[model samples]
Target: MKIAAEDVTPVAFTVILFLAWEGACRLFHIDAFILPAPSAVFAAAAHYWWPLLKNSFVTLWTTVVGFILAVVFGITLGLVVGWSRAIYRGLYPVMIGFNSIPKVAVVPILIMWFGIGEIPAILTAFLISFFPIVVNVATGLATTEPELEDVLRALGASKLDIMRKVGIPRTAPYLFGALKVAITLAFVGAVVSETIGANAGVGHLMVQAGSNFQMPLVFAGLLALAVEGILMYALFALLERRMAGWAFRASMSAAG
Candidate 1:
């Protein structure tokens, strides 16, 4: 099969943007300490490949663990709240309040409670990423059409049956959308935890580099993070397409 124009357009644009960035830095003779060229960043990554990749794995593991916890708790609570007006009325406000809390502000407290270790890091990631999943999942469940509910009811379907067959299937796309956002937040939480108190991981490396003014290494760490985020976003996007193919197809048709 041949690549479509639509696909090639984005790849071309990305290449152009990268070239522009590389060219601008070189043309301006920017200081390495201030803004190193992309080439330098790539060199740095190659130089410290083993250590950087190890740190990346540590961060990746923490992010994945936190994401799993967030999805489990968020989906369970979301389903309960969505299915019951009484539960929603009583708990929505509290959930909203918790989400409104600045995640950064809670880092110190998290450290104190969970210790300056991976637990705090994972908990921080979970907390930061959970709200979106909860809200999106609940919204997906609660927003089912009245006509659809009526049709199911007329078919003698029980509440549990409706939920399992209709609600969850419909809600999956939104759940995956929430997952895309959650992945980035999880990474941020892990990095923040490592930067503040932990000994290993990319965030710790970044902090150490910054203190010593090792600009190239700092840029290298940042590049690693950016690549990780892109990979995660791509992974979620692919999964969404696969698991929610009907929803994706409908969306595409609508857009077209």
Candidate 2:
């Protein structure tokens, strides 16, 4: 019953939040241009449903494509770095430097090169998200117990054998955790890039609406983004629990 109540808490709180927002707007007689109520946002969404759907699809695909690339590249690079102390040390600083730079700044350069389209958005998503995966995966492998490694070595296990038998499997939880984070970052990157240059997307739609003083439509675009982001994040959270159930169980046991 406690677990069930805990599960309902977020939904309940979200309902309360929207109710409060609507009441506040009504009580203050807030200008719609400044802060459209949830009802106004929903009405705008229903009215512009088709454009929202089309642009949302565009954003979704771009984010997914970029996230897929980030996963493949991040996992492969992480494995290579984690395989050796020297390589990891040498590459770590470079990766830090790269990740520290704002991805929004990179968008203009991408636009210049790609000439305003989905490609830039995809690349932006890839660049923004790949770092966390790389860090988490490499950390997972690098933190493998030295005592265990010695035991494996004593049993005549090679480095490759240890990595295949232990390191990769141990990193599964870390990889999935990073995926949840990276997927959200990927959405941010795609939207940022689209807002900067793309001809179509939720970001672009919001920009257009804002310029036209259509605050309700602009807020509706934001609502669309929030819904999509929540769904994607939830999907990965479910995947993490499913794929790394052992890790979850172990952590729960440890906590208990």
Candidate 3:
């Protein structure tokens, strides 16, 4: 099989960026404590592979669990809100107000309730990620065409029938797009809560390394997080392509 230039571009760019970083570090005689070079970060990762692997897994687990919860709850609520104009109008303001508060501030309250553990991290991840999913799904469904609805009514389609046949299919692209964004936010939420309260996770490991002036390990932890986030985003992107590729094709055809 032949590899496409599109597939190679990001890898090439990343390599160039890292090479530049390594060169700059050597040229400037930069202190390792300030900004560890790529080599130093790699060395730290190799030296403490077990801790990095363990903490990375812990963070991934919490993030995935939280994201699952968000998907279930978010979809359910989005459908409810999208079902009616009154419900959508009544709820949008409250949801906006809630989402507006910084998630970090809510972490303390979660810790107080859950007592500084994985629960707080999980809840924080759930809280941070669900809003976009809800908003996107609701918007998709609520924006369904009135002309189509009238046609469906003329054809003797019930409200539920129209929703099942049209609303959800149309909403799939929006929901999947939301999923990609939500997963990243979930990771952020998990790591933030871990940094503040949890006993284990990449965030906690980074904090410990920073305290001991282990800048290389701190950067390695960051790298682990980036790898995880990228993998998850890619997974959702793949799933979106598989599940809603028709939508993309339709839109492209329309544009053309």
> TM-score: which candidate is best?
3
Candidate 1, after superposition: displacement of residue 128 in Å? 0.9
Q: Quick one: ranking by lDDT, best first? A: 3, 2, 1
How would you encode candidate 2's per-residue C-alpha lDDT over 108-204 as one tens digit per residue? 9999999999999999999999999999999999999999999999999999999999999999999999999999999999999989999988888
Give lDDT tens digits, candidate 3, residues 1-256: 9999999999999999999999999999999999999999999999999999999999999999999999999999999999989999999999999999999999999999989778999999999999999999999998899999999999999989989999989999999999999999999999999999889999999999999999999999999999999999999999999999998898778663
Q: lDDT per residue, candidate 1, 1-256, as tens digits? A: 9989998997898779768878988999888889877788888889989879989888888888988999899999889888977997899999989989887788889888877878877888899999889889889999999899999999999999999989989999999999999999999988888888787889988898889988888989988888898899899999998999898778668652
Question: TM-score of each candidate?
Answer: 0.92, 0.96, 0.98
Task: Provide the overall lDDT of each model, using Cα atoms, as 2-decimal numbers.
Answer: 0.88, 0.94, 0.96
After superposition, the stretches of candidate 2 with alpha carbons farther than 4 Å from their true spots are: 1-3, 254-256
Model 1 TM-score (2 dp): 0.92
Model 1 misplacement above 4 A: 252-256
